[model samples]
Target: MSALIDRDEFPLLARAPELVYLDSAATTQKPRAVLDALRAYYEHDNANPHRGAYALSARATERYRAARERIARFFGLADADCAIFTRGTTEALNLVAASWGRANVGAGDEIVVSGAEHHANFVPWQQLALERGARFRICELAPDGRIDLDQLRAMLGPRTKVVAFHHVSNVLGTINPVREIAELAHGVGALAVCDGAQGAPHLPVAFDQLGVDFYALSGHKMLGPMGIGVLLGRREVLERMPPYMMGGDMIEFVHDDRSTWNVLPHKLEAGTPNVGDAVGLAAAAELLDAIGMDRVRAHEQALVRTAYERLSAIEGVHVYGPAPDARSGVVSFTVGDVHPHDLATILDARQVCIRAGHHCAQPLMRRLGVAATARASFYVYNDESDIDALVAGVRTAKELFGHATV
Candidate 1:
């Protein structure tokens, strides 16, 4: 596996050769390809894109436009103009809520969201409903941490203007039925929006096949640079919505009295733009395509399965989420009486990185009856050795906390 794609491609992994990184659900380590792309862009193509006619500016403009086209194709969106770049998933969700939600949703309208959503997907809609006097409804999670489709169906009504959810839960790693959810939302004349931050990194997503109105994803979680994300919406939907942010790039005409917004995507993306990181994100997408998303999903699935089995085998450890096939590449678990933070600290001492917190899904945490749980998420770079190291670290935590037996 290392021969296929060397771990040394990531500078941090090459430097700390012994680091077992298990927190990819937060952010992934970038490959050299992405790094070189960013550096090369700034070194050779540094200029304000789409605003100048000079040679350097034209080159930069082409690079920026190509990056958008590349990312749109990578996500299976045919019309590249529909892909809107933003800071990350949070900003993308806020864009939809602030622009589309505010325009379409009024008093007595309804917006439905799942219980397993990250704060990015949850807060914006909740606040949107509050501001619009619309009803904000949360669908409950199944016992296995998957979204309860039945409950969601019951929540949909004539007044439902939007239904938002995560394609995969950041904490539980549940892979949602996005196509079905989209269909359900459409059944009631509601637009379906998905938070694909976790999904795009681990699974193959076809926008047309899924039939969703809007999908949001972050670049940093998929081996790309930070401060970049994609908001994909249907062409008509994007064209119909108002501008998310008002500023320089997103304008078609400006006057002392009034201004007209730009095209489909540019109207959503405001300001100078993160041109270099956008180029880096395009490079990352190319690398992932070369690896084949199916293989990536398989690799993470195997690691997650091993992690679930080994972690759950511990004397008093409890793992959350559904069966191995039902979830993504994350495993959230609690050890005996040890706090998640303590367990994470012990693992960090062993040079193993893991995430420990409510994972920005405090509602799900409340449902699970725990303040937080230690999470170990896998990616293409992880292998069996990493999982073994994590299991050993958990056992060490039990021993240090005086709960080890046998």
Candidate 2:
């Protein structure tokens, strides 16, 4: 591990000294600082926000607002008013599909998404297109899982209403050129929506500089607790859309016949907010700030490049995606004649944790001509020894399956 990361800061990793956890692409383990934040919120400032006059509720409301501001600044936003809290990345993406997508995308209009998107970023747009009689076009990928930019350009036209994609691929680990994609969308007068669940955790993200109209990220993917995420939209764009859900906190004046919605963020946040998780996520942002995302990215890529090289040397192993230089920290591979589930099970016996199956990327699996591939992902706490354990486990799986190895 790099000097920037203290493994002891994460209670779960410190408790399981023998565990080789490489599934950070799914969710990262929470640090002690984040844990402490959650406990403090519940112990002292537990109350429903925005409706009460007591000191407890006031404190809760203030903490939630402060967290929103801190997180917005972390992501390079001008203010917290444009950012809305959601359950996670899935809900954030769905909120856009329900509101902005439905409002702007009409019959004969087109929605273009990359072939390498996770289902969270793919399904909603597809369903919206279907429901609204719009064309759902898939921009194909190159053989190495990189987006075919030429194909994407050819597909765009005056009818293109939205161009949605991931900042970093969950399966291929390819970091898509966000600013370039956003520019292309703008060239066609289409709105660009980015799923930042994979990018914000590993890279330094400036939301405005990316030029996207809207962006979404999950807290759990970046050392915060589960069930909390954010959706950031441009003020002008958000002001034009209707509320995603109609309920208590989202409304301003409710009458028997009709009701008016609240302001920018509260208009979309329909229910009681997740105050504790928000506080925890804010603490996570602080930790990442102190460690610096640049160092974190360098460390993980070095480990991944090493792992990719070592694994490719084995006789039965076939790694997928572009070269190590083009990828983030994830490596997906298949062992000869062994199912990914079986390989994952064997690795579990050695106290190793990795993700298997399509990784919520079934389309990409079909593109690769396989049903599934085993994935090992890295984070700040993972070191070279974890990659060694992964390689050894792959070799053992090959040996047990009667496959010859170098």
Candidate 3:
């Protein structure tokens, strides 16, 4: 077994040494730096960020702005003001659908999305197209669970106003070709929107180089706190859109009859922002940058390779997605005749934590011809020991179910 990561940095892992945590695609365990940053914010710099005139408020505002800049830099975004804070990736995608989709997509227009999208990315565009009288088209996936680019190209036309797709499938762990996809959309004069919730956590994403108009990311998936995410958009596109939520912070001037909106990102962010979580996310980004995303990706890749090789050798274990090199750290599979939930419960008894069911990608599940799957996802903290534990737990489940080995 490979040596484990320094669990001491994450108190949860440190406390539970016996537990095997393989559900990182759902949410990662936070580092102490992130927790300390959150605590320090409330202890020292807790104030309404943009509206106050006092010292604490000024300090709070500075930190909040610094957090935004730090996150933007992490994603290789040139314009810091293009990073708009949202509750999470769900809210970020919704903001795009409501603000950009409403104005840009007219009757008879088309919004293209992939079947591999999480419900967060899928439902919003579908509903937005329904509301706007636009056609919501699904880009079919290849047999290997990748976006069928030929089909996507055939679907894109002059009426294709927007194209939305996940940079990495949360269920299949298939890494979509973002640059190529964005180029396809741009060729058709359609704006590309990438759901980066999975990609941001595990890959080094250069937003400027991706050629996408907008990318959505979540903090909690990247060793940060919950309730904080970012919608990094092109400044030109964002400036043309309307405010997502009309409220106190997003206003420039409040007339009794009509109120003007703020500039750039502030126009998109409404109400008191999640300042504390934003700080936490910044600290998380700092931690990732310090370690380097390339190293993190390599680490997860090693885990996936080890896990995939070992699990695929087992009888009746049908692993999904591309090979380890082509995918992220996630591995989804189903054992013969054993339900995913039942298998998950058995694994839990062995102190192995995994995810089960549709993983919020019901369309992908249906495409795979399965009701659900048992998924084991890796992160920096996971090692071969975790994979071994999961394998043993699966064997135990097979034994208990009286399944014969090949």
* Every model's TM-score: 0.98, 0.98, 0.98
Candidate 2 ranges with C-alpha deviation above 4 Å: 1-4, 404-406
How does residue 308 of candidate 2 score in lDDT? 95
Query: Alpha-carbon error at 68 in model 3, in Å?
Result: 0.6
Lowest summed lDDT across 10 adjacent residues in model 2 is found at 1-10
Give all candidates' CA lDDT scores.
Answer: 0.91, 0.91, 0.93
Candidate 1: tens digits of C-alpha lDDT, residues 251-350 = 9999999999998778888889889999999999999999999988888887888888888888899999899889999999999889999999999999
Clashing pairs in 1: none
Error of 3 at 165 (Å): 0.4
TM-score for candidate 1, residues paired by index:
0.98
Better of 2 and 3 by lDDT: 3
After TM-score superposition, the amount by which residue 325's alpha carbon in candidate 3 deviates from its true location, in angstroms, is 0.5
For residues 1-406, write the lDDT of model 2, one tens digit per residue: 4424767988888898898999999999988999999999999998999989999999999999999999998899996799899999999999999999989999999999988899999999999999999999999997767778899999999999999999889987998999999999999999999999999899999887889998999999999999999998889899988999989899999999999999979999998999999999999999898889888899888988999999999887899998998889899999887899999999999999999999998888888899999999999988888988999999888888887432
Worst 10 residues of 3 by lDDT: 1-10
